[model samples]
Target: MFSESMGRITGLVPSRFLTLLAHLVIVVTIFWTRDINVQASLPPDFTSEEYEEEDLNVLPASTEVILVIAVFVLKKKSF
Candidate 1:
């Protein structure tokens, strides 16, 4: 039956591998769409220097957010 075949396929692949694949897909999707996203979020007259400055400002905040989320996930998993 189809269900049986699907169950066998799922069992053959590790859950961690699936999770990594999903993460990679999402990262690639974001990477490809970022220019469109930035244009929508920024003013039409924005220069390259302004965009670079915005990117620099975001880097630290994004890092801090990732760290906080990582800590939260670790703590939750420890419980």
Candidate 2:
């Protein structure tokens, strides 16, 4: 039932257009996140050492997350 509705919807739009739209969305998200200042999201009381340690912990995790998401997205849909 759900597949029937989705097929009808997709039938109206070319597959290439849908694929392009997905890529555009990913690019826009990356650019939008770039505009945000990470430090601005942190608490004011954070010391330099605390900030350094926080960065060390967060950077690797964030990087891994993005890479994982990109891989999943690309793998799910061949582009």
Measured by TM-score, the strongest candidate is 1
Clashes of each: 0, 0
Tens-place lDDT digits, model 1, residues 18-74 = 675566566556555656666666798999987876666545544654664565467
lDDT of 2 by residue, 44-73 (tens): 786777666656554654565566567667
Clashing pairs in 1: none
**Worst 10-residue stretch by lDDT in candidate 2?**
1-10
lDDT of each: 0.59, 0.57
What candidate 1 gets wrong by more than 4 Å, as runs, is 1-13, 55-79
